[model samples]
Target: MQSRRSRTSISISQQRMLSHSMTGLSLEQQKMLYYVGVDVGTGSARACIIDSMGNILSLAERPIQRQQLKPNFITQSSQEIWQSVCHCVKSVVRDSGVPSEKIHGIGFDATCSLVVVEEKSNKEVAVGPDFSNTDQNIILWMDHRAIEETAEINATGDKCLKYVGGQMSVEMEIPKIKWLKGHLPDNKFAECKFFDLADYLTFKASGKETRSFCSTACKQGLLPVGVEGSTEGWSRDFFHQIGLDELVEDDYRRIGGSVKNDNKGKNFLSAGEFIGAIDESVAEELGLSNHCVVGSGVIDAYAGWVGTVAARTDVSLPALAKSDREKVGIDRATGRLAAVAGTSTCHIAMSRDPVFVDGVWGPYRDVMANKFWCAEGGQSCTGALLAHVLTTHPAYTELSQLADAASVSKFDYLNSRLESLAHQNKARSVVHLAKHLFFYGDYHGNRSPIADSSMRAAIIGQSMDNSIDDLALMYLGACEFIAQQTRQIVEKMTVSGHNLSTIFMSGGQCRNGLLMRLLADCTGLPIVIPRYIDAAVVFGSALLGAVASESFDKSGAKSAISASRKSSIAGDLSQHNPKNSLAKFGGIGGDDLPSPYTAPSATASTSQIATVGFPFPAPDDVQEEQFDEDEESGSELNFKAQSKWKKDMEDRMKGRSSDNGDTMWNVMYTMTGSGKVVQPCAESHPDRVLLNTKYKIFLDMADTQRKYRQMVDAVE
Candidate 1:
């Protein structure tokens, strides 16, 4: 089973003998270069290097270890996490000297964790029997050792456990492959392989044993449900009801019969052939360039959500632009949920439909937004419950020695000692003693609603004065118990269908602005905030290496090989799927649709298109840079005009009026505003698109808004 280029053929034959002792150097020749991303978390193993305008240029890390043995077993060592992912990809190409044949495409992301891989003859075995057999295999993503095989696959109430929200999660990989086929039944023929630490690091870099629907639907619950047609793969009667029915024999070849494809699909392979070379024995032990292109893998939070939403062009030009200028609803398949928040919090989201959201795990497909369907759900501990309410209180080492003699950081000297003991107070009166300190949060147990890993933690408003002002009101009630457990999974993903509007946030408790205004006053919405916060996962892994090197159409032309061929494009359409509706615009009913479950712009005339809603005060003085290591230093992406902040978002919704008797119909009848607006009746597309100005501002609103202000002051 050794193949990621013959088990990293000594780093691609010692970087092809150092690229024939360095030939033709035009400053290390570049037509296009660098894109590696590897991730593997839950205790380190990173690698970044990015370029092609999404920027990063260098980064590395190693760690991994994780043992525990009892108190609910944990183990790891797929040969010590692939030798700590080849010592963090040979220390991020020896601290980015750049010339690994000018690196092209390579991606990877991890921590859905579960690698085992066994079949070796010429070498490599031991997934562990302890006693330093040393090959140590791998299990970790907080390994619980399948708590009774995840309560016997949730006692088979299975309808694929209602697409994961119904529960099975002993943190996935079908309860760690039914606790390794019922305790290693003689090492079950030393199980050829299983993988998921980003499909065992793209089967250890391109010996390509494929499998990433972001690791078969977030750690093998695998359900795309439907995007088109639907021969729903991976489910041999739900893996013979969790016994893993020998991974449906032959064709599955022990988990990797193929299906990797990143951006669009098919074996499209281009981070330009892993920026060509490297793996010639990992290019003679990381000197690099056995032909450089090592890409097509992702998972470290979908390569940090494609390097933190590739420096916003409404979220990286609708996912790395130029597919005839891609744009559709929810910015082409909803993403935003992000969250990250340090010391545990993931959340995520993304949708082009498949939604299963119960307690949330995922519909997964395309991992981090390609064709869509992600899900996720987090809070295994929000900033470890604000460092367990400031280091288990009792005035945490005297408020960390008066915040280390005022060099600040006991949460900035406890917010300057609650702003000098609230001298006429207001951070909303210290967030109302953080609503009487109630945090029952099962510490590290309840992963998603109640995937309960030994239900432990409990705190509920204690007392008898342990001052430092009761540890600053129990650290603002553990940051409002991590924003009321992410507003109880946004009220269970709005009853499991999801139409959620805003919340983007990032890690390190999003550098706490009173914990991002108490998660925007406990999820009432509006959070966006990514004007480049330490490269959101390295600009979402350098926009997946500029969409695997087509480099946003400056004509390198490949665009990650989108697999087509099934188009006979029929339409009598009505199966009625307005994509899991919460309708912020998605329609198709007909005969001026006002019902048949509303849409065709929810009933039409929309001034043949010219809309605009609340656009007020648009300019925030643009200038948000951070494209490090220079691909011409970031943000020049105007993508062909529209600014003056896109025509002041069309004169702030046509200079708002309804002649004072205000209602604006409960702010356009809330689904969080901007409710009815849909366009694309196609008079050659863009006439100031926002679905043709939200269907000509709701057909110049005569049904009210006071007969659209006397039909716009009788056409002015």
Candidate 2:
């Protein structure tokens, strides 16, 4: 394939002629904007180049090395991971043939693993039991070595724990940090500075220690600046109570800064907010432009949410006027969950208000969107469980041979085998083929709605037969377990206040047709797959890059207003008198919020939005005037009412400075994209009934385990 630059290459004379011909266009219009998104997963680092419209231009991936030092203790070399990142990034840029100068921004997302660096040496520090290997500095997210610390922290019952689903997991940064302090030599622990892997990538790129709200809020337990009834951002008392007062005493320098102390110099940016320009040396190494800015990074799962949550859905509401379609979209978004499935599955759901689901991590403020709260529920082992079941089964070699012979993957062959078994058994569906099999896949422990790391898996109804058919049955059971747990999680979320109606799924799991179908049937929710299934998380990072680009910040309001003016409704309003149309609708005014009618000025900085006591509008009232719509006489009254509401909000915020704040209003441009919808099978009612019965048994299994533990303890 010809490279993009090779195909578009032109001589100086042709360039001059082309430049002269394009003189009528603005600089922004003449240049094609591109962004690079890099995603560091548990097994590989993937990168992609995307146009401004969210289309993937070129992609590259490189494998990352991991070492399992012991059971539940996994480690990786940050140096090696960075090398893989650089390699993938450079490959994407070279393969795409897009000029480095044209790549306006770059963003990164990674597994929420912990990276340890020595403050003095600026080098990797050993995180594994082997102190000699400094290269193994990253504690993989699946590492559960912090189980004791997690239990100790949870025992304190600190008020801060409420924000993190009433208990911190061994997977979170706090417990891991505590584990390091207790286990590592005092001098080594004192010398370390910890970073969530995502923040580490951004810090490496920008040469800045700025942390992302997605990382700090979701993983590090930083109270978002704007949560109601909270004045201080970090809970110093909680930190002290948890026996990690050194962090508080040091003003959180090792992690991030104290949110309460302005002197700490720790900057926390939300997702898509600009961090800084890439470091010159790093830029050269990655083959990117020095001018390219870096965006605030997100945990890989949140990046999955960023990539898929804003997808256009087919649902339309008659009650909402055409002008209120943006409102409708927001409503739809709140009802849709983004299930980023891979080695583990993270179910991310947003709500207009905080929804505190027990065992689910969050009510995290301003992580995904500016005002919306996000809840994350997860299963610690899904993909890994399937892999384990297949790779360990006696008939695994037979299954692999058959799959390879048929020119299909093992999963594909298993899915086909399950379908054939259902047909042979005259079952209602493939789901019925596993009716007698039950798998409680907590092999790595449950991450959410249970928050237990000590839990174990229980498989019932296994046969003595060691055949390919038996292996297929085991795979089906594991898939069913994953889907049923999803249903349990959704139920927990719904009970807690989130009204999830659809599942926007991303990551490698999206390619599993069996799992996808099972997820929909088991959850009874339609699953929407993104355009690039495996690349969705990276694409989301690219969207972040597009948002952070200088062109986006400078021309955002102009583009919004221009697009609004082209709308039939705005056109009709302009027909009466074009010059004063905006004034007529009360759009021409000084406002505290990021509105389409006003361009951001120097006085309005992004930081001001984080100030204590700023009266941000209620979530429902945000961005009502920003989206454009078609004209409809029947909706004129509704538009007028919205205009009145906007004017009221402006009056309320009149004295506030319109300075810098990273708001989602500017993100509208990058949010429009396409996806494939996987609706629930219409004929799966009988399967649904069978699954519902198994789901009841699934719930009972957890309770029975607890009872068994109690009985065993009492005897002791």
Candidate 3:
């Protein structure tokens, strides 16, 4: 199939792209040399136009098209994704009225999906079941078609697999490649070339074949992504074990044998080095200047990390005095975790020393801007799960019609509706709505701490009521579940020596007032939603641009690539396995933890949850320059929600059904709050235990279905 380019309507004046429609007043627009950050998220491509000081001038987005060929098969068009990127870039440039030549540096970030192309024709290679449809060549990062292959690879117990949470996931490229090798026409495997999606975008934009250290190390499952003190070379034993030794044949060119050396990846940029000047033709095509430099890109979540965490450090460092110098570097950078939440949530923390947490993705040496070791934790779904629940619910049509009538998006309408329902229920907010409904967010799978791909999402206390109120409460429950998952990851990290003081968050969920407040309240950790919350990823990519632009003159980038760069020394990494708890991921069985079978103490009623569990103050719809300029508004907002919230959580778990003869996973769905004191807002005490007694029902149902599938497969 000939996939058409994604298009956007805009004014093109004199072959130099003028800006798109600018909304509201600009927050100090500088017509001087600007940087552009392009972020390709799961659903859309967004671009941010920023000045020298990391202040965003305007933003624009173009949606990418995707195809779900089967329940477990997802595919995309590299050409279309690239086209959408181009459209977003052009649109942002047009929207901000920034001239083509004035744009100095541009950086890109994308989901770590796999893109397959035929080098001979420079066209997508057919990789799906429908071989004739070459456009379906890109495998989405979320696709699970390679699960069996991943399991087979895991069975081999290759050493390199240890770096990836000690398991080979269907999401990684290695397993996907094996699946493709076994599924596709044999010749096609040799005929096509593979590129992680981020690398593909950079190649498309700058005509450079160089890959980012982040993409190759973290996503390809080839480089020892987060493991320290190892050669970043392809594992011959692993390929042979998996029966695809061809990958190493003929100079290992298919997967690129050359990699970042222990000292430095000369060709690899440390998240922000300039890769190449934009190609002349592509520059002209997108109305960008030949002077536009492409910064070394990163995986989308890492980009979000930069957008959030770094907003506190790097941008504000230059102004610090000599006395504050010692405090400026490693300690500050390592103290916070970047929580990039969208379709999925990836928790990234950096440390001067490597952290070896089982069931976590990284502790990769110098992965973040080539300075700190990064540890990665993730949830397979968050906003994506919430969307699924809302859209697939019976109330969706009615909800959508009402949302349309109110001239607002269904999400926004639901938010307002949820607040009204809380008022109607005589509660401070609908946070306690979990009393009538509960949701487990692992619908996609558990990505971190537990690293269980077989895990499934569950909901208890569901009813036939299809009213907007019911849907709204269900949405609230889903958000709380996501918050609980964050706490679980945080607990794992905190236990592993990375005590995160603050959480810097970016992505779609940051804007959801309810989720943000719950995250803060539940975790008892302050979440700084950057002023550029909506464009955080784009800004993160832009920071890469800032580091890449020659005028910006990042000596750190040069020194990182210099011969003086140090190789990480190997550490004693004999780490214990993450606990496999059916009831919880956070210290599920330690003496410190409460017994799973134990009942909650006679704590006060949950009336206080409704009191302190209020949403963070509604964000100013348009962020002001004062907040935008201060970048590190590690601006902490605390919801004085503690005791009652904790008691309610305890109640939800106390009466859950056990697996008597079957093994029902005791998924942790809520956080035990921080003992931090906050001014009390309400004191109404109410008994709300919605998930008790029903836990075993959902668990049994899921287990039964799970076994039924296994039995059916065996019969086949």
Candidate 4:
């Protein structure tokens, strides 16, 4: 097979798009200048065309194909992805009736998955044996096939790891590269160039070495730009120490050379820097004018930040903490942390100064659009977990039938069914159904403050009621836990010195009303859903392009007209105040709230709600309060379920760890990496009891991971 240069030829699909008069008169309804933003996500590629006013004129999506070669390993084709992008761009422009010449610039954002190619020809390489097609060389970001490599790299304690929330994981590029060397030493893996998926798209689109600081510094675990001593970029000593010394001497050309001091001074570009116009031949093939500038690309999450807080209608100093004028994504102001939820969810919090948070990734300088430092907390699975919950249940077929009967999608049915349940039980609402169930949500391992890459999920309070309603209740429980996980991250960040009071959210998951409500309820904080929740990330990409192309200026009258800013954005809160529950679990007093890191929880369920916390609900349901009674005081249903879930999780770790096979730690890697064993759950009730019980679970989870990791890397 011959190595082929990127953009050597446009695919037939792209050509078909150009041939059709797709950009018809509707797009020509007005002769307005527009910018296009392209967001390449795990499931699809979306493009949005926005006029100078920042209002979207048209939006379109093209699904990208993914192949799961094996358990815990996923692969994709960059060619397929690029074709999807072109299709979406043309579709949006056509639907909006925007002329090709009116499009000023385009910006791209994508998952931080790794793309591997031949360095010289920019041709895709065969990533693994299960893939027969060499062009399927992009490794999905969620792949965890490099656990052993990740452990080895972490053992070196390289300074770069510090930028990644104090530990490294198999999801990042360094470990993936190490896995490539260890597993396929003689194959294409050994001789390849790597680009975090964002840069890969930029290179494919503009045919230049364009890399954004957001993806390069934030997700790849590189030394963050603007950190005091990181001007030299990659640390050769750390590379040699980890036994991957080959990456050191030749200026680390395979992984990233644009940042190496020797490579034409092509250091990281801010999210808004225009990388130049799209390649002329490619632009023609995709029906775009040669003048359409392509802006530097950003990780999909940072792009979410752009659309949510920095959109055109929004002139307020966005959530950029405090920083200089030149940075992208950075505004003169800051407020809420933004949660971009999809397959995996990331919580992005910005602070004026660097805050060293344990287990959370970042504190990366200039990475948040060159303004405030960034702290990222994430869950490995969110929407994916909920899908598993809905599909695997016995009621799934019935639910689907019901949904089809009602002429709605399954997810939409999920919402309607829950509302029906609330309507059926006059004394209770959806909250009543959720109270009967609980979930751990980390079936794919913990990715935030707990930082365990090997953690499995757990469920409690399941009943023999295999009805669709039962499934709905279980789904509600799963959403609750996902929200709680975010709450845990928020608490951890608050303890580490952030003054966040609200969360601004984007992505597919936010479209689920129950999810947004539950998150607000569990965290006891306001949850702000941007107008275009489903395409906020895509819109954010356009915002970057608009800024890059000078269609949207930050210092313009629109911004200056609304200079006064409030500390928090307001939103609807859940009827139940879960802060009492959070406070109890976090272990702060009911009267005075102290940072959990310094004060710590004393016992379960005793912590106090922050004085400025969730809106106090007019006491509606007393069941949550009733559970606070001693073990001898209630029906023991909730208590028993909670206990059962804990025991199953501990047993899962014990059983999996005892094996000596290659999958000995499969439970940890795929689900979780907990270390301790405790007796069966004890039936108990009380806000204090619940809080203490859950806290113990968190502690055990953390301890389990530490012990297991130590065991794996022992000096045998």
Candidate 5:
């Protein structure tokens, strides 16, 4: 069979002629630039088309195939995912009625899974346990089959481990690569070329093998050249210690080549930086214009951060000034946390200077934005945990039937049941319904503050109840457990100097009001919901495309390219002082290194480095005048204004109903894509005492589990 590239080939002169014809169009037509964003999540591939002002015009989705060969092992097909992406893009462009030539740029974001392909033919290589199914070339991000390899990497105590919180996670690419190398045949391993899923998507679009800094620095063990006093991008000594020294041969060709010595001329791009035009054959196959450029890609969660962090909010929060709400400059981003909650929850915080937090996955420099360091903490499972709890209950079938009969979602039905229970028991709030129950929600494992993957869930105060009321209580307990864990994570981050005061959330979970309320009340911080919750990640990718297109000058697109180039250049380590580095746990001297099994405690004397080049703007800076006059006119509308608007709208729409009627707030969200802000209950609220008590119990549950583990080990 002939390849798709050969079948859809177009001559170079035809492409040039097509490009020249666009200049003859009317001025208004030339100004109407559009962008496409494709997101490859675990279960599906989604695409969206957005105009210059960030309004999503059309969206589409298609489910991809996944295989579970064994427990804790998940695999996928790269070809099938690519097909889904193409179909979704085609559908969105057709539905939106946008001309192909008017689409100026495209961007991609995907799970940080690993992909293996033949170096010469670019054919898929088998990664399954049987090693015979070549279509299953992708190793999912959630696969825990590399547990032993993770332990081995952590045991080496290499200096590179410090950047990943002094431990390696099985979820990262290195451990997964190690597992493949040890299990696959030597011939198959030698012929393999590895790419992160996001990079793979880029390569599929542009036919360029350029890797992204976001993928290399965060998941793979590549030390960014200028940050952390490193002269070369890849640490050869660390690779040698990890027994994967073959990867260092040929300038690390198996992976993306090293930054300083890339023989293949492959560039490592930052998020939204340009990566050449899309391949002509690929553009034809996907029903796009050949003139469209492809932007560098990012992990899905990082895309969520990009989508939600720079939202134009009405309130002046602790993180950003009123003028800076539309821009995510380094200084303004420090006080905000981007919690991209879905099947799992990833908490991303940025800082002007590197702030090392124990058990967090970063302090990785120049990954998300230029001159900024990102620290990532996460929960291994949140939505999955809730699903497990709800599905395993005896009343689940009855609950589903009732929800269908009422034309409501199961979660909404459960929320109503909990409210009724609260009323019947005369409880202060729904939180008080689970007063006697306590849950430890590490069913998958702890991803932060402990960094232990061997931990399991523990529940107390069970009474063998099998009724719907009992199910509601259990669900409430699980939600509370998620919130309590968030509190612990925030405490860890704040103690290490993050200073987070508000959470900007995006994903499917943001639609769940009960979870949002619990998150705010539990953490005592306000939550900022994005305008588009389920589509935020894909919208973020579209933002990346917009930045690459450079149609809007306010996005700082040119500066981003310059900063990435400067960071990638060799002999540029003057800004990073060796004494201030956290490579040795705050640069402590001697053999006093902490154990590899436990997270190192942050010391009071931890180094604080000054921000280089990008200084914090002054309060009275004149640059604030550069904003559009219309934006500045009504920019002072705070949370109080939003609340009043909501109330007035509710009163106006009273007793009116529609097919889409769920709540007045949701109706408001649909009509105007204006997001909602959820604030914590007052300090004197009736449930405060019970919540505090439950939080204490939540803290103790982890310690109790550790003691149980110790007892079991002692007996053996």
Candidate 6:
């Protein structure tokens, strides 16, 4: 095909002339008005036009191309991504009819991937010849080109690796760069520039090669500075052992020199200062902003988390009154858990102190919206798991044909058939049976707790029936699996000091009512599905711009409000009435204490509730002696209460402790990179089974033999 530019240049030129005509206006009319936020995802790129109010005026999208080289080697052209970004910006601005001079700021968020650029004398060169001159730099985020390098790095047992979930994923740039060095040494020598995709976007827009701490902290193994006792940004001994010592350049030039904390007060580089006012020369070519600010960007998932997590709501009803801002699901509290469920699901929770969970990624300080430490746990295929569950069934082909004939989706058809069957079975206790046909979902390998990528999926029970009745059960099972996995994460986190009260869910999957209901029933916690699941990333980027402008600090609001407003904001989406909307799993009940995150099944014989956090007895749960309020008035309430409680408990336990010989103790373990595992003390519980899920134990025959011996002795 002929080049698009070679053919579309004339119209682009005319559009450029029209854009510049506004600069001729008077000085008073010259306003530092709007800002643009660009978000690039796996399949496409999007640009948003927003004024100072955080309203999204107009947004545009342009699809980018991806090529799978080898089985695991995924590649993309830096040129293609840059062009798509520019195209989107121009489209949104043109479609909005907003004056170019009015756009004062710009921000970007993209997938965190490696970009490889070769040096010829000094200028960066393309990786290959096909579209070499125009587009041969970026390595896509999903690309697993460095699996071997990642394994090798992990083998080093580097202290720095602990910051990123004990294992260094091949998806990061360091491993990819290492792969390039060993596999393509000639290219490695010729290469002068390497960047995370987000950094690359900023470089393309503002002519700067700076890196953000968000990228380095999460992906590039940057040993955090100011933590006291850390020598360099990375561990020098660790890097030298990994055979890529050169990555730690003296001036930090190859990746970045300066770190721009967007949360701190840092203005985005003005349009003119970087890309030269998006002038006629460029405007006639790409048809973009002349006065718009082009901003430094962030990873895509981080952007999504930023947009929707913190919002001040005015819902005055008592139903939402139980919503504690200090709770995990509400915006008023810090350290709340927000799970973004899409093709995959990212579970994010922040903390005041860095608490590292064994298999979960991060202790990433200041990475997510800043101020607090972030811990990210996720399921690799959340929505994708649901898709796989529906599509691979034997009845899928017939269902597809029937749905096509009816001009509706297979899911819609399946739901209709399911509802009809449920109506017919209304007299029977079929819904009870439906709940038992549970799905133990590990379909896409476990992303957290188990981090076992090679583990295959299993279905506990499946009938040969291909009717819609079977579909409803199968669908319910899928939702249950999602909730179950989340429960496991909550269990582990609670043990380590996270007090989760609610789950804030966002993403397209939150639209699935059956899934949402199952989540409620399974987790037993109130699920807050944000009004705007799709446009969260844009809101997040706009918030970043607002923070940079000192808006949050000035208002004492803690969260920044966007300057430009979108057509319809994300927070305004309403829950669809199920009478007309799709059939869901479960729903909102009366304002009681929202079900616990892991509640026991009502039908199950065991009355035990799956309480999180080390399964310890709460102080209040224990019997305490009563004290006269007037007599204890001189003493503090807490101290006096504790004193009386301790005396009463001691007297009660005098003979019980000696007779039972059962003790409840807490054991805390912290894994260090030096291969020294510290267990302060090991506690034995007689009343319950104490299994430390934090450590890896092999189930091989020899290990089984050892465990059997311990079990037998414990029982004795």
Model 1, position 381, has a per-residue lDDT of 72
lDDT of 4 by residue, 449-513 (tens): 88877777666677788988888888877877787788789888899887775577777675576
Residues 491-583 of candidate 3: C-alpha lDDT, one tens digit per residue:
778887886777777765665767776676656566665545566677778766755653122221221112232222111100111211211
TM-score list, all predictions = 0.29, 0.80, 0.71, 0.72, 0.79, 0.66
Clashes of 4: 31
Candidate 1 per-residue C-alpha lDDT over 575-683 given as tens digits, one digit per residue, 9 for 90 to 100: 1112211111111011111212112221233243212221111112222222223233132223122122222222332322211101111111111111111111234
TM-score leader: 2
Q: Write the per-residue lDDT of candidate 5 for residues 518-590, one digit (tens) a residue.
A: 9988888888787677888898787777555542111221221122222111111122222111111111111
Q: Which stretches of candidate 3 lie over 4 Å from their true place?
A: 1-31, 224-229, 260-265, 312-326, 427-429, 550-716
Q: Which stretches of candidate 6 lie over 4 Å from their true place?
A: 1-32, 119-136, 185-192, 258-291, 313-333, 369-371, 401-413, 427-438, 466-472, 549-716
Alpha carbon lDDT of residue 225, candidate 5?
Answer: 72
Judged by whole-model lDDT over C-alpha atoms, candidate 4 comes out at 0.62
Global fold similarity of model 1 (TM-score): 0.29
Each candidate's clash count? 61, 8, 9, 31, 0, 23
- Name the TM-score of candidate 4: 0.72
Q: Kindly list the per-residue Cα lDDT of model 6 for residues 1-716, writing each as its tens digit.
A: 32222111112112222232355654322322355677777778888765433445677778888776556666777777778888888887887666754554466777777777653332444432223433555667666667778889889988777777787766677887777676553444435667777766766664445466567777787754543245445566776798876665664556564233232322212111111122223433335443333334567776665554443222222323354422321133344577777677877776667787876777776454333467777777778887887787776677778889989766667666666666787723223445335355665455676665544455657878886567656865666567667767766677777666556666666555556654554444556554344655654554444332221112211111122211211111111111100001011111112212111221122222221111111112211223333432332223333334323322322221110000000000000000000111113321011112111111132234446657888999
Candidate 6 lands at a TM-score of 0.66
Worst 10 residues of 4 by lDDT: 667-676
